[model samples]
Target: MRCGIQSFFFLTLGGAETLLLTSMAYDCYVAICRPLHCHVRMGRRLCVLMVTGSWVMGSINSCALSIPYCQFRAINHFFCDVPTMVTLACMDTRVYDYMVFLSTILFFVLPLFGIVCSYSQVLLVVYRMSSAEGRWKTYSTCSAHLTVVTFYYSPFTYTYLQL
Candidate 1:
């Protein structure tokens, strides 16, 4: 069904977004907390692997849910959300709903939690620095990262969570 295919695309997009935010936070943590080893820890190969893994996970999650929704054609939301689209199906959607709910928790909520935790620890370390130069440098780096995270997340949260 067209709705199922659209749902797959949107779910993959959402999963990839969540993974990207999580990876960015992890990169920042290494850059700030272990600056000496950042180059070693976040090498090109590792970066590529992380990105590839995220896409693989996103694709798997998307396909797993979308495959079941082939019976449905209508989707209620302006955008494709698996649960919402599944609700429009004429057939039973309990299993599909459960899968979507689980995938959301794993791909979205858990990654967000990790990102928040990583940033909190990074901020705590920044706050404890005594020297003016150290403080300024740390603050500068953190402010940039925070600005980016806020810019990306605020609108998404406002649109999805509030709605």
Candidate 2:
């Protein structure tokens, strides 16, 4: 019970972070690639919807943590996560393991792909800018976003996709 709760929250928070980063990447794409339409494309309602969607997807991913486990009481890791929980399972957890993998792909990998595509478009726009000032500004904005994505996703994907 305790492990399930811990894993659920951990996975949920991780999912939210991933989706939020993806959404930020998309925002950058719209701002840089379609500056005129960025306001309309990323309106207040759209921002709200994106946040809600992130949390919903996170909750769905965490739902896979509810598998039967052995009588083990200690988690090897600092916190209870899917990998640690899997190690505690007495039954064959291949299916659950696969589910975790699929969830990682869905919640982590797909968003990463989207982020890459978004930045690619942003880069193309930045490349064609008439003013060096504008180009530098765009690059500065994107570099910060990319840095955050790298710092957050590096450990996240490492932890979840190791399965």
Which candidate has the top score in TM-score? 2
The lDDT of each candidate is: 0.68, 0.78
Writing each residue's lDDT as its tens digit, candidate 1 over 1-163 gives 4554665676566666767777778888888888798878777886676567666655655543444444526554686665465556566767766765666566666877888998988888888887889878877877776787778777666654554
Q: Identify the runs in model 2 with alpha carbons over 4 angstroms from their true place.
A: 43-49, 63-65
Please give the TM-score that candidate 2 achieves against the real structure: 0.87
Which regions of candidate 1 fall more than 4 Å away from where they truly are? 61-76, 154-163
Task: Give one digit per residue, the lDDT tens place, for model 2 in 1-163.
Answer: 6666666677667767877898899999988788799778877887787677667655665554666655756766787677667767788878877877777777788999999999998888888889999999999989998999999988876776654
TM-score against native, each model:
0.75, 0.87
Mind sharing the TM-score for model 1? 0.75
Clash pairs detected, candidate 1: none
